[model samples]
Target: MTRRIVEILKKGQPEETITIQGWVRTKREQKGFAFIEVNDGSSMSGLQAILNADLPDYETILKNLNTGASVEVEGILAPSPGKGQRIELQASSVKVYGDADPNTYPLQKKRHSFEFLRTIAHLRSRTNTLGAVMRVRNACATAIHKFFQDKGFIWVHTPIITANDCEGAGELFTVTNLDLNNTPKKEDKSAIDFEQDFFGRRAYLTVSGQLQAEVMAMAFQNVYTFGPTFRAENSNTSRHLAEFWMVEPEMAFCDIVGDRDLAEEFLKYIFKYVLETCPEDMEFFNKRIDNSVLATADNIINNEFERISYTEAIDLLVKSNKKFEFPVEWGLDLQSEHERYLAEELFKKPVIVTDYPVGIKAFYMRLNDDNKTVAAMDVLAPKIGEIIGGSQREERLDVLETRMKDLDIPPEELWWYLDLRRYGTVPHAGFGLGFERVVQFMTGMANIRDVIPFPRAPLSAEF
Candidate 1:
């Protein structure tokens, strides 16, 4: 049986015969023997194997065992003389499955810029940085499931194709099956007739699954949707992605304060879980990627997130006398710069800003008694501004309908959603956490594109 490098590295005893399969990360040839480092994507550190001159097909195998080559080695584990690792493999037999031409391989034995690595997305995971990122990403995902499952939250799968624009942003990616070469037109011949489309009406890749999650939450009491969401906005920034994953958890009979508490606990749980599960990868990120990675994780895990109302945050920002690009006001939405100032500069920790102006927040958010603001909240992390956005949903049918009418959203289109309030509506709350943004925050990766495996952005969807 082939042993995973992680398991072997953690518990394998010396002088045990085993076989390992992985891609060669580095190779150093000598007159009597050769040394090769192999990684199987199981851990941050690869297994270092020493290939002797008397191994089968030694000369030819040595030539083929370049970086990026696939190989299987039968070896006996022993104490390493190297300083970095505790164990090494002494190979008795080696088989080279495939060879990577050093002349043409994009990933050499040196550092490459993130931009260049993105171009070779198919091969970039072999590099140390990307490899560590992928492992951490996996750990984060597993921790998400574990966190929710431990609390008896049902894992709900929401639809990818939705008819209503949940965010009301008008940045939806339309889903249709009409041939544009011979399209169906309206009577005026100006617009394509969506009546003849596949779904018999306009459909789109879901921007947010909170609505569907709300439906399930009403039924199950607690539920979450972790799935891909899309937006058609042409944002070419380090923080935006056309396609990404979201974690949204909805709870029935919960209020704004309960929602805020859940978000804080959820974030702390994720940070602690990832730190414990992927210490090596996290340490690599701290030393090489960003020096603040470890410290930030420690802060999140140990500290209680600071909380303030949106009005109070604005007051603080104003009192600090910091000149922001976008002016801070009561009715205006908070920009990234303002959020960073509140979380990173003023608070020096994660800040939960609540009770945003109703005019700026979603129509579904529960309106406060003040008649001007809604029970909406945003969890702003130190580096990644707004990490999670959530609100206590409006459960009163009359108020929800009025809010929808005020926002000019068609109430008839969301008949099923309205039905939930019409029948057995209970106060419910949830938040949407961007999966990539959390990974980027945890690893201190400079670019959001680097955190996701295949990033879809404006004019850039190569893989």
Candidate 2:
């Protein structure tokens, strides 16, 4: 049976015969023998196979085993005399499934800039940085499921096509089947007739699953949604992506305090799990990608996060000596720079800022007794600010209706959402963590685009 390279490297004993099928990373030829590294994407480090000149068709196989060539090798595991790995493979037979031409293969045995790699996303996964990122990403996904499942949270599947704008940002991508060249317009011809569309209404790709997750939480007590979300924003920055994954968890009877507690525990759980499961990959990220990667993981796992009110956070930012580009005010939302200062420089740990001003937060957030702020909180990490944003949902029907009116949101469109409150509303709470952001944070990847395998951004969806 063919064994995965990770399994062979970790558990295969010396003299044990095994077969591995993978793509070659590098080939070094010597007078008597040749060494080639093979990786199957199971781990960061590949298995080194020693090919002796006496082996049948050694010259042809060695020539075929250029970087990026796929091969199957049957070999006996031997103690590696060289440093780094515990064992190496001594091959008896080698079969090349495909050969990557050294002249045309984009990924040669040299350093390539991330910007250049973005152009060849299909092949970038074979690179060390991207491979380590993917391993860490997989570990994070497993950890998330394990954490929620252990806590008895039901995994909920929410709709991808939604009619209501949950965030009310008005940056929705309309889903229509109508021919744009000869579109059906209203009698006045002022606007396109969405009634002729597929849903008979203006539908859009969902920007979030938080609203649907809330509905599930009301029934299941605790539920979470992990799925892809789309945005139509035209941002071309490294931080923004047109398509990304989200992790949103809602609790039926939870308040802001409970919400804060759960977010902190959730982050620490994922960090700890990744460190234990992918230590080698994490170490590579620390050494090659970012030196503070391990230290960030340690800080998250060891220290207690600081919690403060939004008013206090603003006061601190205002009093600090550092100059900020954005204004430090009570009503305005906190920018990334402000968030980083609080978490990285001031606290040197994760900081949960709560009780945001009402105007800046979404209408669903519960209004504080003061009526000027909402029961919302954001968890900011050292390197990346505002990793998680959540709020205690406003359960009062009267308050919700009034807030909707104040924001000019029509009541009929969200009648189903309003029904949730009219029937049997509870003090529910939840938060959203950008899945890519968490992976980027864990791996110390510079760009959000680098962490995800195929990134979707403005005018950049070739992969």
Candidate 3:
């Protein structure tokens, strides 16, 4: 059986014969023997194989074992006299499945920029940085499932295509099957008739699964939705993406306080899990990518997050004596700079700000007794402004209806959602965490595009 490079590096002893199948990372021709580094994508480091000149077809195999070549080596393990790794492979036979021309391959020995690596997304995974990132990403995903499942939260799969714009931002990608060359129009011709489209009405790629997750939460009591979400926003910043993954957990009989507790615990759990599971990778990120990577993780795992009200947060910002680019006002939303200052400078840790103004929040947030603010909360980390946003849902039928009507959200379209309030409604709450954002935050990767494998952005969807 073929042994993974990670296993061999960790536990393989001398004189144990094994075969490793992977792409060659680098090759060095010595006086008597040639050394080639092999990686199978199982870990951050690769295994070094020593090929003697006396072996049959040694010259041909050495010639074929370029940096990007695919090969299988059956060798006996031996303790390396080298400085970095523990063991090295003494190969008896080397078979080259495919050869990569050294002149043509883009990934050479030297360091390449992340911007250039993104152009060749198909092959960038072989790099040390990208490889480490993917490993940490996988660890985070596993940790999420394990955390939720251990807490008895059901993993709910919500629909990808939905008619309701949950955010009410009007940024939605329409889904249709009608041909544009000859479209079906109404008698007035002001708009195309969506009645002839697929599903017999206008449809869109879902911007969020929160509403559907709420539906499932009503039945299951505690449910979480982890799936892809779409957005049609024309943003070209380091933060926005046309397609991304979201983790939303909804619970019945829960209020804003319960929601805040769960969000804090969830983040702490994920960070701790990643640190424990991928220590080497996490260390690499700390030493190489960003110096504060490990410190941030330690801050999250050790310290209790500071909690304050949104009104209080605004007041602190105003008295901070710092000149911010955006105005620090009561009604305006906090920008990234403001959030980073609050977490990085003021508290020096994570902060949970609650009770936001109702105008800035969604219509479903529970209205406070003051009628000017809602029972909403945002968990702001040191680097990232708002990591998680949630609110206690409006359970009162009369209040929800009035809020919907005030916002011009037609009541007929969400009749099913309204039905939940009409029958057996309880105070519920949930929050959404961007999967890529968490990975980027953990890995200290600057751009959000580097965390996701295939990033769909504005007019850029190449492999």
Candidate 4:
């Protein structure tokens, strides 16, 4: 028996016999006939099977056919007048693989909560909604790789476990040893020692691939890294996650403006790629997930992204009537509310907020001539506050050293980074895009948990 997709079978091919193996979605038995709905993980719509009482194992199949039962169904594909259905299968045989006790199978033929679905994550992928999401996610991931490869950018893999916090944010998951028995540096003064920590000398998960990407950029001129980054922040919001994937690209001989331009182009390319490649998925999301998805993609592709200074963004926010939880100010870091106000209300379009105050921005950001602000930019979308944050790194050795000193950063940890400037650094710039943030923006998903396969936030990492 040949396996066939229900969608393919529904193309009006006459008298076509096919084999479909899937979990039974629903089954209804009558005196003369039995109808069953089955999906083989190929499409949302499943092939309905019509079984007559005269078929072999008529009583046994009917007795076992129930929702959630896994079985191989062999039948002849035919047209159906079943209201919404376009196709059905006339079954001659049923092969049971897994029998589901109706009472034990938690999932049914109805919608379920994301939280509830998350609890049954092991089985959630079987659901139409989640299955579609996973498919879209896989496509997007592939698109990212293809997008970079086509553009002649080298893909670099930065280490996940690192000795330094790239962002200086102090958020890291410390990797440890399994054997608590044989610890290195068994004992130190006061009988307390940390030299035994897995990697030894306080190593932890990487916060960003930016710094390493910078190293690769210097060597290759243009390089990118797409990988997992860990943060230990405890905030519970729709956006924050403990472990998230980031797409970071560093370019040599590029300034802050170049960094901002790259961000805009990269995003536009992703939007175009996904929209063209994942039309069905996007259509489903536009209808079921967010009604504005198509429009959002249209707007992104059709319009030019606006650019403004951080100070200008603050000014716009201050004039607005939006009551922000965090007060808007020029010198302070823009909260998500402030960012949203700028992107959502002020600009009413995708915009780049740049030139943040040196004190508020990262230490590696290049200092402007004013000696007050850093040459940094954050691309903010209407719904998502800050989707991409990047900066033209301080390439001047003296200036970078002074900034590091101002931040009270340990000189030893960044010796190699500083060496880049000392040796041959030529005004490099780069940005980090939270991959999940992009998916959330694309799918209109509200929670970071739903976009990622196995979300490892502050507390949840069970699976």
TM-score for each prediction?
0.98, 0.98, 0.98, 0.92
lDDT minimum window of 10 residues, candidate 2:
165-174
The 10-residue segment of model 4 with minimum total lDDT is 183-192
RMSD, one per candidate, in order: 1.1, 1.2, 1.1, 2.5
* Model 2 misplacement above 4 A: none
Question: Ten consecutive residues with minimal summed lDDT in candidate 1?
Answer: 161-170
Q: Rank the candidates by lDDT, best first.
A: 1, 2, 3, 4
Model 2, 1-463: lDDT tens digits are 5788888878889999889999999999999999999999998889999999998998898888999999999989999999988999999999999999998999988889999999999999999889988889999999999999999999999999998865664388888889989999999999999998999988999999988898899899999999999999988776778998989999999999999999999999999999999999999989988999899899999999999999999999999978999999888899999999999999999999999999988889999999999999999987767789899999999999999999988989788788889888999999999888999899888899999999999888998
If both were scored by lDDT, which would come out higher, candidate 1 or candidate 4? 1
lDDT of each: 0.92, 0.92, 0.91, 0.83
**Model 3 poorest ten-residue lDDT run:** 161-170
Task: List where candidate 3 sits over 4 angstroms from the true fold.
Answer: none
Q: Write the per-residue lDDT of candidate 4 for residues 82-185, one digit (tens) a residue.
A: 77677778888888887888788898878888999888878887787777677667767887888778888999999998888656755678776635575445
Per-residue lDDT of model 3, residues 335-432, tens digit only = 99999999999999999999999999899999999998999999988776677888899999999999998899889999999999998999999988
lDDT of 1 by residue, 87-172 (tens): 99999999889999988978899999999999999999999999999989998999899999999999999999988865674499
Better of 1 and 2 by TM-score: 1
- Which residue pairs collide, candidate 4? none
* TM-score, structure 2 vs. true: 0.98
On a 0 to 100 scale, what is the lDDT of residue 23 in model 2? 97
